[model samples]
Target: MAGILILYATIEGHTARVAERIAKGLRDKGYRVDLHRADPAGASLDLAGYEGVIVGASVHYGRHPGHLRALLRKHRAALAARRSAFFSVSLSARHKPAAAQRYVRKFLRRAGWQPQQAQTFAGALPYSKYPAWKRLLMLAFVGLAGGDTDMSRDYEYTDWDGVDRFADAFARPLDAI
Candidate 1:
């Protein structure tokens, strides 16, 4: 069987971590998974070899990476021809579910690619990893959003169990086939 393709775009690295967890869940179910990082400079992707594909991206400032949107536009037909899913990672997913859903809707509408499955996963706030300006900015944002504001440490909001469930759901139809 052709393997499942797990492609992701991350800025602060949390989205990549989420993608890895999803890949692990699918692999545990006996699916071959290929994990690839989406390049911001636009890398060509061929989806013919994969039985299914899962695309993930982190939303920053209300937007997903432009290159990922471009990739979806370019590969929409190939992705449509196969089983596919999309998951969006963002801070809004943790505090504001509606906003998170809007992000996904906007992204899909702009890209013109609708996957068979879609989900929203809360992301992390890696305060320690950010530069001073970003850390302060995030601190203020978190404070206003009623989230963790401790800049000395990072906060993770992702639900691992949910990610596993999503992986299982994506694999079910393929397994049936």
Candidate 2:
């Protein structure tokens, strides 16, 4: 069986958890899986050996991490050639679905990445991890969205069932490619 690669770019670690869950789900389904981070430390890696790829990233302040953008640009050809899925993690998806969809569309347009499948997953808010300024900003945003405003704890909105469904859908096309 050809291996699947799960690449992720995360800020506060939720996206990374999502990537790991996807990898584990695929592995449970009998596919070989490789989980890799797209941070600067992982810049040397490529998707040349994988039969299928799944790329995931989190959004912060309406933007994805710069390293993830570079990674996509660098491996665009290889990524486009394979059976691939791209998932975006954003708190906006949890609060406002339309805006999140627009964000994903804009991201894809800017990155020039047209994957076989794309999804938007709700992200988490790690209030404890945020600095004072960011915490205040996020609290305001969350409050405006009618979401949790508690800074003493974190909130996760990821839908695992949706992720499992996505993984299953992505896996179905691997054999054909």
- lDDT on C-alpha atoms for all candidate structures: 0.91, 0.86
Q: Would you list the clashing residue pairs of candidate 1?
A: none
Candidate 2 lDDT by residue in tens digits, 46-143: 67779998989888878776677767877788878889888999988898888888877877777778999989999898899988998999999899
Clashing pairs in 2: none
lDDT of each residue in 69-132, candidate 1, tens digit only: 9889988889889999999999999999999999999999899988999999999999989999
Off by over 4 Å in 1: none
- Residue 2 deviation, candidate 1, in Å? 4.4
RMSD of each: 1.0, 1.7
Per-candidate TM-score against the hidden true structure:
0.97, 0.92
